[model samples]
Target: MTSSNGLSSLGPEGASAAARALSLPAESYGNDERLEAMWAMKAYNHAEVYFNLISSVDPKFLKLTKMDDEIYTKFRETFRDLDIKVLDPELLKSAEAKERWRPFCNCYEGLVEDFNFGTLLRLDCREDYTQDNSIFATRIQFFAVEIARNREGLNDAVFSAKSSKS
Candidate 1:
């Protein structure tokens, strides 16, 4: 079957053949664990970009506007609807889990329709790469929480914490 992007869906045999052509190990391509790892890595990279963008701004100039707060509230409700504990960093690995979260943001606009994936945040959690870490979150989720933090003077605490450790 052809997808909306006009890319034909590859069945198992075709996928395996494609993987072979690309010189990928059979265990890596189309493997759930491997796919999850790739998703996590991609999310992490995206989050890092967002963080750098936020950090580049002067904290005093980063106050959230009314619209930012509204976005944040909308995100909170989205999480609530999904039965995901708000602010608990957990990677939404399944298509179903991601589908429930992505509509709130234009993260995938101009991208393929089947491109569904997102991250979560656990700021209180340690910096390790474990699921508890907050290093990965959906683009909009990151913006919502971080914008709220900036407006509420929470980033100051984070900055202080980082400076103290240095």
Candidate 2:
């Protein structure tokens, strides 16, 4: 029953419900500061390795996953209209985009290890993974788009630039 007091007035059931609610995450539901830091570190390392790879070798030959061909094909089929060469911020971060991406992400659930783990994606395939140019994505999403870029000859410019410098 409603009363002047809080949960105590409502009795044990209300108190227990309140206790459960209080136990939920303070910030975002799944967020843990320490775990977030770890994910950031992992994303940074992967970005570095990917940068080094595209810088030295032709991105066409650089495969991030064992099923590179399949990933590329499915990505193209799923997102036929998406311009993978230029990773649009709206496409990456919008609520609409998340809904659109959910089924595509789910397809790789068993095929790719940690497919949904957070990763740093370069907004522009032609540029380095600078802070302003990067956004967080899933591992499979990153692989799919990057593989598409490489196959489409979008990332060849990075190799060309590096070669010119050498």
**TM-score on alpha carbons, each prediction:** 0.43, 0.79
Using TM-score as the measure, the top candidate is 2
User: What is the lDDT of every predicted structure here?
Assistant: 0.49, 0.81
Q: How many backbone collisions does model 1 have? A: 1
- Candidate 2 versus truth, CA RMSD in Å, comes to 13.9
> What are the per-residue Cα lDDT tens digits for candidate 2 across 27-50?
644666644554465577778778
**What ranges in model 1 sit over 4 Å off?**
1-32, 49-116, 125-131, 135-137, 163-166
Sequence-dependent TM-score of model 1:
0.43
Decoy 2 TM-score against native: 0.79
The list of candidate 2 runs beyond 4 A from truth reads 1-30
